[model samples]
Target: MTRKFTGLLLLLCFACSLRLAAQAPVQTLLWKKQLQARLDSLQRANGFPGATFAAVLPGGEVITIATGIADSVTMSPMRPGHRMLSGSNGKTLFVASALLLAEQGLFNLDDSIELYIGRESWFTRIPNAHSLTMRMLLNHTSGIEEYLEQGDFMQQLKGHPGHTWKPTELLAYIYDRPPLFEAGKGFSYADANYILFSYIVEKISGQQMYDLIRRDVIKRYGLKATEPSTKQTYKGLAVGYARKGGPFPVAGAMVHKNKLILNPQFEWAGGGFVSNTADLAAWAKAYYEFKAISPALRVQMREGVAANTGKNHLYGLGMQIRPGGEAGMSYGHSGWFPGYLTDAAYFPDLDVALAIQFNTDNFRLLKRAPEAYLLDMARILATQVNNH
Candidate 1:
């Protein structure tokens, strides 16, 4: 070979390697900057204290960003590890736990709630109780009413601030309410379903809800910062914030009212877990990889039910399904509570997952903004991953 030809070939190889190396970090940085810009814009537009987000690619790459204060009062900055209430997102965890138990042959998905909890005279007194089942509860097809909508339940609790509720007592509050529709006929989101599921976990596993989740789910994934809400502030925790004038804290409440607050005990299992973005990302990866549950159960978790009209929102055992368009589809659940909002999604085709948590009650803005921005960011990240 001629020296000049050899030199040209070597130059081509060097340029190619440099080009490849430069592309990924450049794209990653650009994606990060874009997410930061969106977060800033949302905070400014909505007057929220701040927001935090964390994401992990299928290949195990991760990015975490905390923009804004966790609490306007103390001027604490939001950090990746700052724990926030996961609200209904806890349902995903419960569902996974239920499936894990099912895989162990403890119970079947189609088993009627009556088989476990039994048809007590008190339960039968409630309308439509006969149709309730474990699957119905997990899939939100049980026709149970949400406890949060009970007349002045919050007011009653605020009046008795020191009272701690047993799961049965909390269940009693909603058991008498009229069903939204026939069991297995519709998908009306209800906390009562998960509250019952938590009880079932205790009944079957003979273990408390917190202990089961810690041993079966959180510990298995090595999730260091995840815990059931204590309804009291802990050291090194992020303070929750409501929108400037939101219904949270309601009127005439005391003791941890009107601030970034959570009643972890009351909302146990249904919506009272607290976790940071990093732990969330790790959990999502573990969930999608079938490390938390069996592969068959994982498939069941991602399958959509036809509880509501038009096939519902593609809900599986615990996770929410986002159907793909041109960008392909993703699956996972999002959460909201008095002072926090979170989203964690995994794209199967791309093998990537992203989680975001904002410690603000600006649900109006949060509902619309973060999902759109994060999905766009995911696309960009996927491009970077594929190019390399």
Candidate 2:
């Protein structure tokens, strides 16, 4: 066999071995101390102001650890309860809620979005408006341009941080824009697809998108600290710090004086939740373990397509599927906001779910990518679980 193919075979074998060894019960206290040490090392090494790490083991045992400062100016020590704006990670919750509605007979995945919001005056203005389906939106195959990538949208967002934007207003940037590609021809990640999805879900269910998420997803899963980023301030929410040379104009305190500088209500179905790593870890465990969705829908959610060429990852519905190497496959999502970066995943072979959140988005300062740190953290926990 070619070297590359041979390498793949060996990697799969190694992962299988790890999974086999992972049946031992986790020693929660030992795992917590080890995780904390790693978290502290990574934080100081990378200059991250603060971070939280959480994991849910095979039998529902949870371990959460925190390190560094939540608000540097106030010298607030980061706590396990501090919630960070989870960025696109919220997409997982949004997509699950949409699927829940479908399970309730409210809609079908193959149904054209036009069937619900097609009559609206602005509906046709969206690229590929007539041909888009709920499945395409869920899987991000709708060929829609990501509104967040548009210069005008970012300008407006940064210019008016407090503006409570409506969905149409956020979508106006891409009103007559061309699709990234023809629908179903290829994969292109786009937040605008989820925006249209929010409209469809709201229209069909006669409830606001956030309400649907809270009712059907969060409440059902008992994710206590997870909620819509609708309000400016939330108790125990961490202050976010932007990278020095980051895209965001504001450098520090994305959440200032206990209030978010940008009104996150506009995020809508496109990742609008702020949550602590503990709740996020719990949500990831429940969702990926098939407790949150039907096994049939769960299968559909795993039907992944190439998200990045040359990357060992795929995008499935709202989740990102990444091979966990010697650990197994991981199903989860990552989030990126101005001053925060978060990653969460469930490793099926090990039956472990992990969530990590950094209060500062200074990835350039890190020795490795934030996702890499999470996988490393997962491997550490996996080994611990195996040893015990």
Candidate 3:
């Protein structure tokens, strides 16, 4: 070959190689060696029946890895795409739906929730119901107690485990309870806030909350695996377990079925959704990273509570701000229900997002904070990516 021709061919090959390097990093040692190694130890150490974790790169590529078993009884391995209950992470969707509607001028966050549900019998007895604004509900400042914490209501749930309660029925537990404080006077996390917000969405949108979210948000964005599962079970869901042990907080010395008790309908607008690691990683980019709302509104949605409280933790509309969640700070929510633990976080500084779900939960029984574990998982992803 002529020297000139050879030089030209070499230049072309170099350019092609550069282009390939720019593409998403394929599966790496991060997944097989580091992540799997660490996650396997963590899962076994924590006693999780199965768990899944995912990370979204700055350029929108995703990596999902799983450990342990999906069903402890059957020993089925957890896969990258296996669906798990979303727990409180569903708050992200409910809040985002409300914000999107507000952005479109369909509603206003400052509007009184009573504007929609005041006439309903359930709200008549709820203290401060007429004075509560949609913003209060989103931020958990509405003074409404969470329905799940009521001993009487929980007894009913336990007594009739097979019965499903409608949204109004869930309200029965909240309506009679005394307000924790005057409207907007305090910060509290309450599922009742979102459940009631779902009512407002249905009233104004003239569709079920599930339909509105499905059509407007999840569908518009191409999240095929993420779906609201109120009362409808998805196939291949991972089995959840409650960790049992003597006193050391070991994960799987024994496990009990911490079956999800809050009927899906009652969980409404709060935590009744299902998703997998891959979809959640994509959803983080699509929904939280700009697929849905405007950048200005994203800032507004995450403004968090007043600074006077001096609290380390901050709660945004649907997200939580972990002051020390990453190399810089981050925003996301962690989800916990009986059998499932789900968590996802987005780091604006790193431009990376991570989602993780575990089939075992001992938060209530073992006093273990599931979010901390999930956050560690995110840190590992960030550490590996940054090193690579």
Top lDDT model = 2
Tell me the tens digit of each residue's lDDT in model 2 across 21-63: 5633335677788889988988787777888989988877788
Q: After superposition, how far is residue 107 of candidate 2 from its true place, in Å?
A: 1.4
Query: Taking the tens digit of each residue's C-alpha lDDT, what string does model 1 give over 275-384?
Result: 88888877776776666567777677777775331223477777777754434676777787766777787777777778888766576655564556557657766676
TM-score of model 1 vs. true structure:
0.85
Candidate scoring better on TM-score of 2 and 3? 2
Clashing pairs in 3: 46-251, 47-251, 47-252
Between candidates 1 and 3, the one scoring higher on lDDT is 3
Off by over 4 Å in 3: 1-32, 243-263, 306-311, 364-368
Off by over 4 Å in 1: 1-30, 244-248, 251-262, 306-312, 324-326, 364-370
| Per-prediction backbone clash count | 2, 0, 3
Worst 10 residues of 1 by lDDT: 251-260
lDDT of the candidates, in the order given: 0.71, 0.83, 0.72
The TM-score values for the models, in the order shown, are 0.85, 0.90, 0.85
